[model samples]
Target: MPRFLREYFNRNGVGLGSVMLGLVLFWTIGLIILPQLSMLDFSFRPNLPPPEIGGPKDLYTLENYKYLIFGPEGGSQDYNAVDLKVFYRTLIAAVLVTLFNLMLCYPIAYYLAQTNGNHIRILALMLIIPYWINEILRAFALRIIFGESGVLNNLLVGAGVFDTPFDFIRNDIALYAGLGYAYILLMIFPIYNVIESLDRNQIEAARDMGASWTRIHRRVVIPYAKPGISSGCTMVFMLSAGALAAPQILGGPSSLWFTQLIYQQFNDNSDWPQGAAYAVVLLVTCILLVLALMRVFKVNMGDIGK
Candidate 1:
């Protein structure tokens, strides 16, 4: 058997490995590498007309990115500045949402993982249930519940809480609420998975040493679950940062999210080069944030799954 395997490897291994390597290279080059180069290429030559299907190449310039990062003078349209603002706002919103999720999810995950009962299962199921619905449908439903004439306001008005309906959509509050609702389940599952695998004896030992609940959590539980918390937060932040539909439907006119700006460039304005540049900026920012979190937490990415 060993001799046969050795012979097969000597003949076919190199060929099979090369084929697999080529396939991977093809996808990497086409999807990620080449597109990034193209974005950089296009960003330099913003105002020039796109090349014909098979026509002369346009000269490269830095006007597009410059216009994006800085406003045009003489009241020229500064879509670039607008795009940059959206990018910054999106990053800030995502970070805040991630922090909120981390604070809320940690205790819940810890409790759920430590406890065992039908009630716990039911609660977990309830949290998981919302994710089963389409995200757009969920966001729309939230909008209805929070809209001026929505049920909450109607109830408040009926109770003489206020004479007029309250505005709940298109504001920063609504945006955060929408993002929180959409991604809370994602935040919970990972933390719960990690906490559930923890050694019960270690917790018990902490308690035996006369440690308070807060102390035990701070010293033992949290340290043990750090990987899970890091993983969950990173996942939620990345998802929320790129989220468009929820913010759009629930955020209203006042809350102009960054993803909307990207969409406008690609779809509304038909400025694919500018849109690609914005996307690249967003991608790089997210990568940096993840790296920062990993460094600060001293988290080994491989431990997230465990």
Candidate 2:
């Protein structure tokens, strides 16, 4: 730690180093730590009605947490099966979306990195411009595309792919597709940046040795780009898991995301304690998933941003 600090100070100089350190500390404590701590406190408190708000002191209980594991009253043998299922489903869907983005974007990223010309800049602009639009607008656009009278169904009908419009919105397809589209750039840029840094000679040498394209990517490219892969997947998974707008917009009545439930508790139901507990659970789960990914990919904590 001392050596690190010494090196940091030496490289950045004392004035800049101190400023950086101070900003980091402030960000860590003020933004991250304090908010979580306050949420923890709120999670323990009971949800009181407006009429009974000031009537009680220290209305802390485990009711909110219990409501998660067990049912409403906290002592039921059966858990809140609906909430539990939706929570896990949301996590699983987020992972699937991350993997989907990785698969969909990897080739595009590789193409952009490997190719040379003004076309690369054009292609990059096209990728970035969509994301500059509001997320809600993007989601609404997707909603329109997947709606019964939308472009996809019309195309499918025109091509004789389906006799009638398929209910894409009623299912999870639109939700997943919207999320993947929303974060495609996040996945693409990282992998592209890393792959561009790789030595082209390595790929050529492997190709000269009669290595297949698949083999070259597996052996010479993927290992080198693991850090970028990890970073991209981490960002996509975290964002997808926490996403509310896209899901709410694209998901049907049957589709239930954990964030929607949290929103309901905080807004519609006015159960702040329960909402806080759910938020904390989500935050913890995301942290655990991130740690697991870092462990699996052998990435350092500091490498995610790069």
Best by TM-score: 2
Question: What is the lDDT, from 0 to 100, of the residue 116 in candidate 1?
Answer: 82
Q: Write the per-residue lDDT of candidate 2 for residues 1-306, one digit (tens) a residue.
A: 699999999999999999999999999999999998989998998887678765665487888888987868644568898899999999999999999999999999899998889999999999888888999999999988999999999999999999999988998789999999989988998999999998899999999999999999999999888878888999899999999999999998897999999999999998888999999999899899889878877898777777
lDDT of 1 by residue, 1-306 (tens): 478756755776868956875788899998879988987776665444555523555556565566567756455664556666767878988999999988988999999999989999899989988888998999888888888888888998999988887777745666788898888877888899989999999999999999999999999999988888888998899999989888888887856887887788789988877777777678788989898879888988786665
Q: Evaluate model 2: give its TM-score.
A: 0.91
Off by over 4 Å in 1: 1-57, 73-81, 304-306
Off by over 4 Å in 2: 1-21, 49-60, 74-77
**Worst 10-residue lDDT window, candidate 1:** 46-55
**Pairs clashing in candidate 1?**
44-61, 68-80, 170-251, 170-252
TM-score per prediction, in order, is 0.83, 0.91
Candidate 2 overall Cα lDDT vs. reference?
0.91
lDDT of 2 at 87: 94
